[model samples]
Target: WDAAYERELQTFEDIGDTGEIWFGEESMVRIIRWLERHKVPLDSSVLDIGTGNGVLLVELAKSGYMNLTGIDYSPSAIQLSERVREKEGMSNIKLKVEDFLAPSAELSGFDICIDKGTLDAISLDPDDAVGKRKQYVRSLSSVLKPEGFFLITSCNWTKEELLSEFGEGFEILEELPTPKFCFGGRIGNSVTALVFQRKKAKPSILDKLD
Candidate 1:
């Protein structure tokens, strides 16, 4: 990511210092409500991929869930994230500097995997779109246990579009647009948010047909 974009990602560096772009209380409330509907609790282990500056991880930590970890490709973002964790005195949320697209042993064993802007970033390049998306899904499956949940938030995809692409091995639990009132800027643009559980059962009759 470019320095400018990195700046945009960290635009909320105040960590609640001012009118910034960090996940606000209302947005967090909505997220928590969805989590309750999905039964995600403090016991859940979550992986926040592309966790630039780790705000979401920090927010999750504040919610009393300690089993949280975050990864981002940008070194700058990782540095800022670590600083935030330290400043907040949150010892349990692990932040790492790694490109999630690359194959690595460092990623595995999480009950929930999240993508906020990561998918949107990848989808911008049409040539690399399909390949990168495949890599993301495969790695997510590898890291998450059977029946693990993937919660993705993207401005680029509609809820139906995400399901059509990533739904083969997962069951959609909640798929919907985010409320416009909770974000910065005009906020009229649509957002696709989905929570899908990995399916453990075999392909059933469909496998034989293929």
Candidate 2:
């Protein structure tokens, strides 16, 4: 993944075609729209894990989100992301070179998190993929505060798969509908976006008395 992202940064540096915007602008825009429609707090801290070129951060900045952060394992990706921010004259978003699976202590207490395609990449990895995925999800959960919202967009997994994967501490809020096409009398969407919220702890009787 690091090598692939380094090549992506090189490609962007050499020619200026940043494939960083993974799926499409439309998909990103749709999520932004959903957040707006739901009146998601703009001041809430947002962490974009696996943020490649910081395109999503820039978009969130444009949408007036003040507390924004992005992390990627690739140093070149972080450099490109920083360059993109500089070019856009945006200083609000923090871009860090860090792995989500082994995040630093500083990468916690976020109120909202967004995953574009990082989960898909992890799922496709050949070595110990399941264990890595579990770690990734745990890391993600740790970084987010209780009741924090998580939005995930993927072309690799269906709604059922995503729902099954994230369940212990996360509750599915809704799955954003995607444009569907009829294939052999069956409907299918090429991509899926699901919103989840971390479940808050229930107060025990003793705690409630206090």
Candidate 3:
């Protein structure tokens, strides 16, 4: 990603000629619509994980969302995002060089988090992919407030696979419709869009006794 961003790509799609799967703008529209449908306040804190070019953050800000933060581990990526944010005159939208699998303390307590292909990219790691994925879940869980919403879009994982991955500390809230294609006389979605809500912790036996 650092190397990719160093190429000075203007948009996330331009990073790797991945416009087909990197539908940041379309995903933003769907995400905003879903948030509106779920009654998420405009002032609610929103974090965009792996915000490559930060276009999604800019769109969210333009849509009246006041508190927005975007993070990417690659410094080059953050730099590009900062440039994009500044170019759009969206100074209020914060851009940080931080890894989602090992986020900073300031990254916590967000009301909502948006992941667009970040997890899919993470899962492609050659070393300890399972461990890294587990860490990704842990880090995400730590940052989100109780009952916070997580909206994820993936072309790599199926809806059922994502549900299973996030099932432990999250519950399915809704699944947004994505573009579909027909192959072998069967229709299937090309992307999976899922909304999950963090589960409130249950009182332990000791807490109950207390």
Candidate 1: regions farther than 4 A off:
5-27, 180-189, 201-210
By the lDDT metric, which is better: model 2 or model 3? 2
Which regions of candidate 3 deviate over 4 angstroms? 9-21
Q: Largest lDDT belongs to which candidate?
A: 2
Instruction: Quickly count the clashes in candidate 1.
Output: 0
Please list the Cα RMSD from the true structure of every candidate, rounded to 1 decimal place. 5.3, 1.8, 3.0
Q: What local distance difference test score does each model get?
A: 0.74, 0.89, 0.87
The digit string of per-residue lDDT tens for model 2 on 1-210 reads 667777877787788766658878987898899889999889989999899889899999999889999999889888888877887889989999988999999999999999999999889989999999899889988999999999999999999988888878899999888778789999899999999999897889999899
Model 2 weakest lDDT span, ten residues long = 11-20
Residue 183, candidate 3: alpha-carbon lDDT: 100
Tens digits of per-residue lDDT, candidate 3, 74-177, equal 99888877777777899999988897888888889999999999999999999999999999999989999999999999989999999889989999999998
Q: How many pairs in model 2 have backbone atoms within 3 A of each other, for residues 3 or more apart or on separate chains, i.e. clashes? A: 0
Q: Kindly list the per-residue Cα lDDT of model 1 for residues 1-210, writing each as its tens digit.
A: 648435644654644332232334444455656777666778788888887666677778877787998888888777777777777888888878877777478688788888776888888866878998888788778888889888887778877788887877788987645666535555553666788898885767889898
